[model samples]
Target: MQGKRVVVTGGTTGIGRAIVRSLASQGARVVTLGRDENALKDALDAMADLPGEVHGIAADLATREGVERLFAEADVRLGGVDALVSNAALGAEPIDEMADDDWRYVVEVNLVAAMAATRAALARLGKGGQIVIVGSISAEIHAPGESVYSATKAGLQGFAETLRKEVEERGLRVALVEPGTTGSDMQEASDDEQREEIAKARMLRAEDVAEAVDFILSRPPRVDVVTLRLEPRLQELP
Candidate 1:
């Protein structure tokens, strides 16, 4: 991975953060984005000793302008892009229970932003460039009370699958990583509850998903991992 240039959205915390660290450790130059300025600073500081260079951009993916700014900074920081990881997402309450604006913001962040980022990256990506979308198993399970969130994920599932076929002719690889019951800031479970579940092999850590991403990118140019689903050993489905 040495000297590879990559971009990762929503990379200041949770799974995205883990992916950034993993890539940096292997000497990949990465530009990552977050909505929080402090989190962006912290993420950059934390990677100071890694072999790879890391840059952080504070941008709100919920808006088109923010997405534009992110890629603009990426273009300046990395010069060119080799991989783009669309990992930013927002969890939402049930559609009926949420305020109209709130639900719409969730869609903007979780779904629309991904599409925008992918579009920008495709313009810059060349043959052998990788696009990895961090999706969720909720799209498949469709658990109750996750109407809005599930809808966005289901949209990503279709987006990633269809996009892969469209870009395969160009030698661009697209992969989707769907994780189930991950312990992240977006999780509703308390810290103790999450820890207990992790210990029981019923919940996955953010780093687990990061590793899956690294594996996908590490594959030979001839190999394309279309989709990889990761669930804890004891995770139960609705």
Candidate 2:
């Protein structure tokens, strides 16, 4: 990963933050984005001592304009893009219970933003460039009370699969990492409860997902890891 220029979205907290640290620790120049300025600053400060360059941008990904600005900044920061990690997502209440604007915003940030980011990245990425989408196992399990969130993740599954076929011949690799019951800010459980679940092996840590991403990107150019499903050892299916 040395000298690789990468972009990670929604990287101020949770899984995305872990991915940024993992990549930077391995000597990859990383530029990450999040909507919260303070969180972005904190994340950048925390990663200041990593082996590689780590930069943060505060940009909302819920709109095309924001995504465009993010890529524009990345162009200036990294000069070129070697990899793109679409990891930003928003949780939502059940479709029937959520306000129209709220649900639409979830769809925008979780699904539409990812597609937009991917499209923007494709324009800059060349051979051996990689695209990794951080998805969720909720898509497959269809857990109750997660209709909106599940729908977005399921959409990502389709996007990643079809995109891989379309880009493979160009030497670009696309992969999806679906994690189950991860302990992150998106989780409804409290931090203490999440810690307990993690200790009991009923929940996965954000770093676990980060490792999966690193593993995918570290592979030889000839190998394309299409899909990786990572779940807690004892996570129950709905």
Candidate 3:
């Protein structure tokens, strides 16, 4: 990434932050987006020594308006985007006991927001661009009580497949990277014993997913890893 321009949404903390650091270290001009003002400032302060330029845009990624604003701002700040990582998403809310408000928020952020960003990114991203939609293993399994979340990821999988074909003519590549139970904000939301149990088993590190993104971006233009399912060694379904 000597001069590559990269954009990572939801990049203030957790997996998103890791991706920002990884790309910045490789000399990519990284622009991060998220709603956390303090966290983003803190992240940027901490990465003061990275090789590439680092910038942040604080915005609500749960709406189309915010996404459009982000892309427009990115155009002024970075000129054009060479790679995009759509990693921000609302977690799965248990469907049986889900609140109506939570359901709407879930769909807006997880599904609609991603769609909006992808649409905008396509316009700003030039030829030879790489788009990676971070997905989950839950997209494949019928996890009890995570209907909306699972469905959204499943939908992303399909969307990536379609986008890949549609944009191939312009040398654009789109792919899906699905990881199982990554070490992220979601892991911290659980208790120690529960986290340990999951970690000791097969939870992936967010850096690992970031590494996958790095690999996808580094590939030759003619080749694209269309889909990847990243699961840890200790994970086994009952």
**Residues 1-238 of candidate 2: C-alpha lDDT, one tens digit per residue:** 9999999999999999999999999999998899999999999999999999998778889887789888898899899999999999999999999899999999999999999999999999998999999999988999999999999999999999999999999999999999999999988899999999999999999999999999999999878899999999999898
How well is each residue in 67-160 modelled by candidate 1, as lDDT tens digits?
Answer: 8898898899999999999999988998999999999999999999999999999999999999999999988999999999999999999999
How many backbone clashes does every candidate have? Answer: 0, 0, 0
TM-scores for the candidates: 0.98, 0.98, 0.93
How many angstroms is residue 125 displaced in model 2 relative to the true structure, after the best TM-score fit?
0.5
Off by over 4 Å in 2: none
Extract clashing residue pairs from model 2. Answer: none
**lDDT values, one for every candidate:** 0.94, 0.94, 0.83
What's the C-alpha lDDT at position 187 in model 2?
Answer: 88
**Candidate 1, residue 120: how far the Cα is off, in Å:** 0.3
Clashes of 3: 0
Instruction: Point to the candidate with the largest TM-score.
Output: 2
lDDT per residue for candidate 3 within 39-120, as digits (tens), equals: 9899999887999888887899897667877787678778999888898887866766778888878778877788788888
| Residue 199 lDDT (model 3) | 66
Alpha-carbon error at 231 in model 1, in Å?
0.2
Best-first order by TM-score: 2, 1, 3
Model 3 residue 236 CA deviation (Å) reads 4.4
